[model samples]
Target: MTSSTHPFEQEEVMAYLDGELSANRAANVAAHLRECAECAALAEQMRDVSVRLSDWSVEPAPANLTKNLEAARAEHVVAKVRKPRGFTGRLGGKFPFLRNRWVWAAASVAALLILVLRIGLPTARQESRQSEGLQLAYTEQSRSADTPESKAVGTASDNFKVRPAPPALPASRGSSPKFSSSSADGQSNPEPTAPMIARTASVSLTVKEFAPLEASVKAIAQRHNGYIASLTSNSPQDAARTLSATLRIPSAQLESAISELKQLGRVEQESQTGEEVTKEFTDRAARMKNARATEERLLDVLRNHTGQVKDILATEQEIARVRGDIEQMEADQRSLQTRVDFATVELSVQEEYKASLQGAPTATATRLHNAAVEGYRSAIESLIGLGVWALQALPTILLWAIALFAPGRWIWKRVRRTSVSQS
Candidate 1:
């Protein structure tokens, strides 16, 4: 490797001539070739030899060379099949097509594809079926909601009636359907259609009696089978007391509750609002139905799967996600139903202001009495606190006094001696 002595070995020179050396090493060999005539001659001979080898060509292969080799291989395979010694050979002899690796790979791929289609098709079919059902349900609900007069007035309880079982459809992938058309009485039933509404009311009242107002509000809520969600009462000096509360009452009893609350005081302000939620509720129900169907299909896939671990795990993960969505949709549906069932009320009550001369004198007398009592108590507490402080600090004071007495006495003597000397 050192350029001082023999920088280039014969093999290095050959490698340089063959263009196999790294860039820097090839450059060094090229530079050395320029300086040393012997290595330069060797490199030139190598290049000439490479050129001659490149020009040299073997005679063309026989046109049937590949055919001859394949024929030989086929004969060897035929001999092995005849002997039929090992298990593979016996199988090959019995089944002549089992010898190709490409055939095995193809069969494996075909089986895998079949399994994937089996699992996938059911899910796709379920989704399509569920979507069709959802669309049908939505269309029916919309038609029903648009023509209110044609549909008879029904109560909220009627709206929650169990839907009639749908007609039986052929199950896919050999799995049984979760729903059926037969009722307990073995008769086809019809679907029930009802409107959903969420109601809210706000009322403000001015009351004469402030003390009994809060209790009356609670009693009214209890009587109506409702609860107060929130309540705030403010009573300031020389100001009327005001009470505000948010109440949740059943929609059936909302009117009664509000009427009773009005009776408790004079109604100053009252407003009621209702929102139609038939479409929203219907949409949520449709989506929830589809999710449940998808979940069922996924479960079927998981049960019948005979694939890799990753595939099984992926299927399980998808099932879990679908289940979570289904549960969330169910929760939302319940929440919407509750909103339709319950009515919210906002109530505000203000106590009537009554000017009175009677409280002034009485209040003044009570304040005077309280002030005298507090003054006496304060004097007694101050005396007791002084006594406690003396008890706590008396020992420490005495110790300091004792320690300073000798120093004080010596200073006094020195002062007296100095005064005598000055005199």
Candidate 2:
């Protein structure tokens, strides 16, 4: 009848002592404790501990605490009796007119209008002004006559003629070239420049042979007075050979060049593109002309004017800036001219693939020997691959083992201790 001989666990006895069990279970435990001397002694020890704990008491609250508690209870009751105020109600308390829905709606509308006026209107106006200015500038430049030097170099209207240059013009400060049509004699009407276009083409072809086709492509480029910009060719034993190249041809000869290139093989895909850069070219030319004019005027000032050291230095600096601008614009103009003169042709040639079926049959013995050799080689390769993989994974495996073992060991110890204690 002792606790050590009873069927119930110590936890059940403790729960009964704490009155946590149902009445029937508590009664059963009480009967068992009366019969079991060990359980009765354990219950007496727990009761003693509880009695000792009860002796420790907190001090009584002050008189002010009682007044505050009563005040808080009264305020809580008042809060429950009154209607709760939401966000709009609190906002209306701060601004009485906001209580009106019509007033709130009107204020929202005013804020939206102010936002549109402050942000949207200015942005629209700025874009409109910029567009207008660009249009006007383009129109003026297009109507202006090309400089004699530009004409010799080949105007955008012309097919980029690389002719010999004429004699240079005298740098006269007294006479400056004008952007608009205005002469000492009269304002003559200006001729419009032609539209400029940069042309490009791409052609994909399937050829019977790569070597002959490649040679023909090079010959065709040479015949057209064009050159190959780049060439890439690859040939694999198990796959079809391929050749890709970029060719630069004269814009005037672009059509004829593409036609000739298509003759090397059957054309699978072909595309031609042309981009108009008339406005851009005109803008650059106009800027260059203006810079040159500025440089001429500065040079005249340096030649004719007498000034102090600072003034001369400042004048020289301005001249240097104008000269730099002129050079940069000239380079841009040349690049644009080159693009307009030379058209790009991207060409790809693929060899038509054919599978071969001509091979001598091997003897059965030889075939068996080859198979065995191949199997052995594969097995060896597999083992080597496994070894390499293990080498690569060893560090990660070790790291994970170290990380898991410490926590695993701690948990195992804790479980073992719990098991021993329960036993």
Candidate 3:
């Protein structure tokens, strides 16, 4: 059919009306639309449809929509340029939903939530267990308040308060008591208690006399069967003397030691901290026990087993590994025990210092004589220093002077000769 008579000629005219056709095609369609009444009517109808769609009011697109569209277009171009290969490409092409931004975003959020649940749940459970253990320890301490001194110390500090421990559980059958919420029933288990806490304290004091305070601190440590881990005294001539000491006291004696130490001076600042190492200690003990068991099993195997040389060597290596693990675990247990047994006290003592104005002034004549002698000495020293510096630089100066002198003299002679010639 002739171009003007073809059915698609009307579509071309509509495309021209919407400015969708290339310039050349649009020109042809425009020419056809002007001559043919049918094509012109079709173009007019399409224009009306466009106007009607524009009139249907809708919310404006979000500001980021343009950026997203541009990004999508770029990604599309890249995908087309380098068509993906393999199973991934085939799967993605078959399921176009996988290419959606929202789908990927949702998947990422789901993955993050799963990861958080996996990691956070166990950590939260462990913390809850530790807290239960601390509660149990505090509860045990509260039932028997035999120490009047500790009570007094607690009463003296406003920040200190006795937290009554939670209700005790029924005695279970074992050397180490196991407390749980559940009792032969399918229910939630009571939280487990940890072992003990390593406590520490820091006290800063302003004392009238540093020496007496120092002596008192040592006495207090000795009385408690504790020893001074370290002691430092800083005394400046015109300033107050300060004493810093780290004291290690038996955990049982910590309260009494702190109270007695405070009595030696005016307490300026004091802070106490208790770190519950019960869980850590318990874990180390369990590990050590397991290691010992493993070592014993290996020892039995080594003693009883009669096998090939290769088998014996392999068994020996296993025994060695088990022994090493046992040693390491034992060391950890000892370190933990040491911390639980001894509490650290960091004490800082500063003397309430006063400046003294008791010294007599020097005689004017004597002062003048001293000043003159000092000035003379300084001048002599300065001269000596200058002579030494000049001597040190003498060779370099001479070398530079010699290097420049010949050239300078020759240039002068040449200038003189030129001047003479000119005259």
lDDT of 3: 0.65
Candidate 2 ranges beyond 4 A from true positions = 1-192, 357-423
lDDT values, one for every candidate:
0.67, 0.66, 0.65
- Let me know the TM-score candidate 1 reaches against the reference structure: 0.43
Error of 2 at 95 (Å): 64
Judging by lDDT, tell me the better candidate of 1 and 3: 1
Candidate 3 similarity to native, TM-score: 0.48
Q: Residue 310 error for model 2, in Å?
A: 2.9
Clashes of each: 0, 0, 5
Give the RMSD in angstroms, all C-alphas superposed, for model 1.
17.0
Order by lDDT, highest first: 1, 2, 3
Among all windows of 10 consecutive residues in model 1, the one with the lowest summed lDDT is: 170-179
Poorest lDDT segment (10 consecutive residues) of candidate 3 = 169-178
- Per-residue lDDT tens digits for candidate 1, residues 1-423, read 334566878899999887899999999989988998888888788888888989989899997998998998798856664554754354445445666668779957975785456444543443454565421122222334346532333233222212223213211111112111112232211112445567789999999989998899898887766678899999977778899999876665677788999999899999987777777866765566556656765677568646568766766888788788977876675576566556789999999987554453557888999999999999999999999999999999999999999999999999999999999
Regions of candidate 3 where Cα sits further than 4 Å from its true position: 1-195, 306-325, 362-380, 405-423
CA lDDT, candidate 3, residue 282: 56
- TM-score list, all predictions: 0.43, 0.45, 0.48
| Candidate 1 segments exceeding 4 Å error | 1-192, 355-423
